[model samples]
Target: MKKIIFILSFLFGFTSLYSQKLSSNNSKAIKNFNEAIKLYENYNYLDAINKFKKAINIDPLFIEAYILTAQVYSDLNMFDSSIVYYKKTVEIDQDFFPNAYMFIAKFSYMTGKYEEAVKYQELYYNHYKLNPTQRARAKIDLNIYYDALELYKNPVPFKPINLGPNINSIYSEYSPALTIDDSTIIFTRKVPVKDKAMEQEDFYQSKKLPNGNWELAMPLLGELNTPNNEGAHTISADGKILYFTACNRSDGQGSCDIYRSYKIGNTWTKAENVKELNSVSWDSQPTLSADGKTIYFASARNGNMDIYVAHMQKNAKWSHPQPLPDNINTARSELTPFIHPDGKTLFFASDGHGGMGGYDIFYTKKINDTLWTTPQNIGYPINTHKDDAFLFVNASGKYAFFASEIENGYGAYDIYMFEFPKNIITTPVTYFKGIVVDIDDNKPIIHAIAELFSLKDASIAGKAITDIDGSFLLPLPAGEIYALNISAKNYLFYSEHIELIEAYDSLDPFVKYIYLRPIKKDQIMVLNNILFDFDQATLKPESYVELEKLYNFLVDNPNLVIEIGGHTDSIGTKDYNLILSEKRAKAVYDYLISRNINPQRLRYKGYGDTMPIADNSTEEGRKLNRRTEIKILYNN
Candidate 1:
């Protein structure tokens, strides 16, 4: 009997210990085969292969010689040659090596022979009864082979353009995070450590030029980059706050922990460990919601890697991390979760979910706060047998950025962008970007808070603070009405409605140059969000959102007395409009009093159609005329 060994991947292995009668009776062939085993064990693959060939040539029916030769080729990663020798063994004796079929299937799939891979996988199952794990893997491989075949026939349009030399280098680059406007990009680059044989990960950034080219990338400016490893991060929509992963630092709660940094006036503050969101297990690869209130990341706290989410609390601390639903996280590993700016679709990479193979990118839609639709594979060539991960789609849902090693890439894992496939794009998102200036002085209002409220439940959809330049940006998901309120100390809060419920160009965003009025007498501000039923004094349910804002404003400035004035369109009689407007104004006044505002501080009046901000001759003008306003009466 001749001993033969064939080592496949860690998932499978095979060895021949059969007691069948010798197929080769030649003494010279037997001697050559024995000598070949020594060279193979010493890792002299080519020499061993030559000796195995001599044995096969001397005795054409030598099954052992053919099997060993095939194993050598397989170990050398020469799948084509391995397949040839393995097939020779099969031809020489069909029952000699049953495991040969599985190897053939694996190598065939590796070499892009999907149809052949499927055939051999099916043949392997017919010949052998596998253990549970092997059986599971066999089924997954079959699904992958079949899916790959179909995908090859009908490929999605994918032309990945490299981000160019300015943003890439001769070292690995990945984990790209972009600002809402796509004007700035920050990513991780792995560079060789001086005087060391290892690489270190650090943050790098580049700004998009007016001509659409990227400026030369430089190490991100701040104390955020340290001697320790830092990578796998996400940026807030405004590009002011950055959340990233750092490992083995003294402050880390886990082997890898998430940290945060702030970009203030082109200089990033020192990173601080986000201890509330960290566990005593390895955690990395964070993605944040557009609001910067919710976060998703990969953690190995439960043994196998899974995606976990945490929310920012009202007290400005992170909530305890919770694992995502089982549909998104399987017993197998999942990683690189990216929540789109729309805040409805979540993209991640999972090996547990059956797909082409390895970690395939999958997307699941957020149905609500606690539920998500079952994940769907983003589909074929975009996800191949290799571990494809770290995908990011822009707000317009037209282009995606990822990192991959290409034939002519600058180096390992260079960043690339591709036109997002239409079939898999999430709902397009738009952002509200503007500067908040003092209405009187025209100076930027720094550190002002902007809160966006959803009209459906009046929930805080997003929040941002104005930069030193008085600029702010926040994402708006499609097809929803939003109320934006911007406020600063000793200043009347700015309020407006953003109606995106109807279809419009999502790429064209809302740009408002907000002017915050100073708190003084005669400073009148329209309450655009306050609404009433047609031809009636009853306030609509949606009106309570603005009413709450009024109550809070009054509470914040206890000594201020204001008049809630209402007006109506010109179609009605003056008496009818005046009476209806008076009741509407009283509705706001009574509601504030009900919420603890002193009645002495409140007054109500109706100006009928006397104060028309626009032409009441047209419907648009009439709509603008039918509004409520807050007029400052006293500030003592």
Candidate 2:
């Protein structure tokens, strides 16, 4: 079988297996064999095949000629034909070639003959003495055959849809990345140059139109893509940072090093080589987390290509990389890692752990933020007896994209997307994203920070800073209520709690167009995220984060004094509502006083149900009415 990424000399090169065994008792066969060997040495595979066939026709029992013919076929990548010829040699005399059994077992498994492949493997093991490496390989092969047989018996749905011509080209395209909203997609495409013999890999981008169709893809504009190759990249969730592979560059610390770029206004800055991430060995295929704090990549450092993860520290320096657990890496190689935005399900291609065939895609979920669970094969049709790598699961967990080099694709390799079954999905993710604009002129506020917190625990779940266009995106899981806070330098902070119910396949994204009012006197803003105990003066623990924002605001603008107004819904008597609202306002007032603010600058009021913003008719209206608000009292 072909090793997918790198070339292994032992798998492709010939072993000197005593070439004089059948050097013919007949002079005719002897001449043909000598000529065939000469042609094979010159790399003339077609003519060598003919010469080997001539010798086989003369002496049908010539085991040496049969072995040479099979080697030529394997070199040509006609693996089925090679297997047939190898089997013919073994059938003539079971002990004719000792390595024939192993080669036949390998090719048979590649062709999906699992039972026969296992049979041949066991036969080779029992009849011949084994070396340490070869014996371990045989054991792995046996396990792989059983896995193939088991998965083939009960196949999952793997009907992949070809991403149409708008994304794919007459050349090759692969390694897809997308933001949480799925509006833009970035991938690597290799197109032929006008006069160059070799095709260079370049990044391309496409956006989904309002009509829900992808636009024509074009080359990505950045200094990252030059005459040299740049590919195998991952885009952060906000679509502002990019991490990719660049080889043989002047600034590279190794043969291939990982590089990163920051997007500044629809244009990317010059890439910088991540010096701490690279070593003296080949390193590439980077997958960065949504928050850009964690990264995983494939490296050939510990004598084999294995997956290693590195973490970015609070000081903005990356720590040393550590290899993944033994369950994921093997004596063989693993490559093409895709860590889902949810940060738990990791999909990667591997040949080390036993699977159906070459580099099958497997996924494992993270237990906590710590160790990962054991790897499991995705399924049969999704993972065939061929190389499958570079899989991407969109944030919604609806579909996946990967590259395949098959006869039916556009060219040497093409990107294909498959809609996963509901059960096969990664963790469900919902998004809340849009542009933050100035209410005065509707211009984007480019420096806004958005924070999301779990309503249950009052702990922050995620956060994002707006990009150049004042656009922010945050990924959240379903079945939870999250409180959000958006703030800027001179604007009133926006606060609200969003609810997302759990549903596996159907997710509706929340698109918010936030308009912020500038800091001015008499401007009233509701702190919707603040909470209080029922019918009591005590502030709930969840109100601390929001109150801290208010305290900080007071400290920043010392001349500004404000009134904390409390209101209630029309659910109780007028006297009860009035008392409850007063106590709640004082609860906030005392908390601020304890924080050492000037007490003379603060005042409290209870509007009760008199200043209701909504009708208080439905439950949703009642939710809106029960809120704490702040108004600018004096600016002097």
- The top-ranked prediction according to lDDT is 1
Query: Which residue runs does candidate 1 get wrong by more than 4 Å?
Result: 1-22, 35-54, 76-78, 127-140, 194-198, 503-506
lDDT of 2 by residue, 514-541 (tens): 9888888888889887788777778888
How accurate locally is residue 90 in candidate 1, as Cα lDDT from 0 to 100?
74
Give me candidate 1's TM-score against the actual structure: 0.92
TM-scores for candidates 1 onward, in order: 0.92, 0.88
Task: After superposing candidate 2 on the true structure, give the runs of residues whose Cα lies further than 4 Å from its correct spot.
Answer: 1-54, 95-99, 122-139, 406-410, 455-460, 467-469, 504-507
Kindly list the per-residue Cα lDDT of model 1 for residues 420-461, writing each as its tens digit. 887665467888998999988999999999999998888898
